[model samples]
Target: MCQEQKGFTLWFTGLPCSGKSAVADRVAEILRSRNLKVERLDGDIVRKSLCRDLGFSREHRNENIRRVTFVAKLLTRNGVAVLTSFISPYREIRDEARREIGEFIEVYVKCPLEVCMARDVKGMYQKAIKGEIKEFTGISDPYEEPLQPELVLETDKETLEESAQKVINCLKKLGYLDHNF
Candidate 1:
């Protein structure tokens, strides 16, 4: 039987279309390939299920983060790596998540707003600009960038593989994974 391994939460935060979800998905794939139990809490998908009643208000956003953090903490303690992809616009909520989830790695996926707008497949950014979406982060609302994230991935400059490899390297460096990676 394989020895049990410690689990950690890899939190990805950024603006809409900033590559947080894409990078998190790639990271999950790599970790799963290495035989790690992984759970991905994507904001869009989770909001539909876990937070169906939640809205875009600050309180709701924090509540969403809290819910995700709670699950992440549970999974981490049970040896399941959790990758959370949320805009998580507020620094306080992100810090709260870090405190609640002991083993947390905050990855700031950096991309210019213009680049993000251009990459917006959902047209949410355009709608936000037109006042169709209220409390929309980065356009109608605010996105407080992480002050001291564990890792910063300039998704605009790096390929998906490079960003994912960086996260994998960080996990190995922090002893979350075997050094052979």
Candidate 2:
């Protein structure tokens, strides 16, 4: 109803186990608690369902981001807050997304590669390092860090709540959250 609550896409980009989804989940939960319309598009789930045929190549990853951005734009147009977590490693593709979605906020989940490998719960980094997985971001593939973003959460140093709160605070500061709401 208010300008801040109107609709925007929160795009979280980072390495594979870099706490993007964790912060996204927390932010989504907090927004939902306020009875706001919200949806989260997770990379893993989207890969399995929406882009199952796509590989981990740069082209495929860019296409995946494009598809997700399209969906996020549509939802935002319909007055839904879209939260997306992905290893959107390329700045160009993320810039494309930002251009396509007018009300977009890019959140960079900053974590060191070593910390990501150590925090990998699924052992993806181990498998990637062992050559069992191909074209893995930060291992076999490259992850281009965001040149400039709305927020940078040091997931390696900050708690999940703190990271999520940072995003929320940014939204408020940017007038994305209506005070009256």
Candidate 3:
């Protein structure tokens, strides 16, 4: 008889260009390879769809996360492994999400601001620096780093594969994944 995989939400949080999405994508691929039902909710993609009307202000940002949290909560309860990549810059909002979603893991994608700026391919940092964009985290807005996240992936110091493995290892250690996975 086959065993049902437990559902959980892996919330990736960091500054822009900090490899949150990249690492989440890699982890999602690995989970899928293990035949787990996975769903990725990336900031940019979700902004273009679910949060298209939202802006970068604190209120809007909080609302954006609220919506994502709701979706994640639903998926998690339904046995889907939900991987979300978002700046989610406030500790309070993240804590709220954790409370709302019983099975939640906060994965802090830790990369220095300078490193993130250097990795920017969209010129978002440049625009924010030039005053072309407003309320940009790590530029104008604040990014409240997690006080005690379940996992921390230092993207600048670690290779993508290493970071991805760290997340997988964390899941296993936390009993989210089977030993064979």
Per-residue lDDT over 104-129 for candidate 1, one digit per residue giving the tens place of the 0 to 100 score: 99999999999999999689998999
What TM value does model 2 have?
0.96
| Top lDDT hit | 3
Report the backbone clash tally of model 3.
0
Model 2 misplaced regions, further than 4 Å: 1-4
Off by over 4 Å in 1: none
Residue 152, model 1, lDDT? 96
Model 2 global lDDT (CA atoms, 0 to 1): 0.92
Residue 25, candidate 3: how far off, in angstroms? 0.5
Q: Which residue window of length 10 is worst by lDDT in model 3?
A: 172-181
lDDT of 2 by residue, 1-181 (tens): 6544588999999998999999999999999999999999999899999988898788898999999999999999888989999999999999999999999999999999999999887899999999999998999888998888999999889999999889999999988886553
**Colliding residue pairs in candidate 3:** none
What value of lDDT does candidate 3 attain over all alpha carbons? 0.95
Q: Predictions ranked by TM-score, top down?
A: 3, 1, 2
Question: Order the candidates by lDDT, highest first — what do you get?
Answer: 3, 1, 2
Q: How do all models score by TM-score?
A: 0.98, 0.96, 0.98
Using TM-score, give the best candidate's number.
Answer: 3
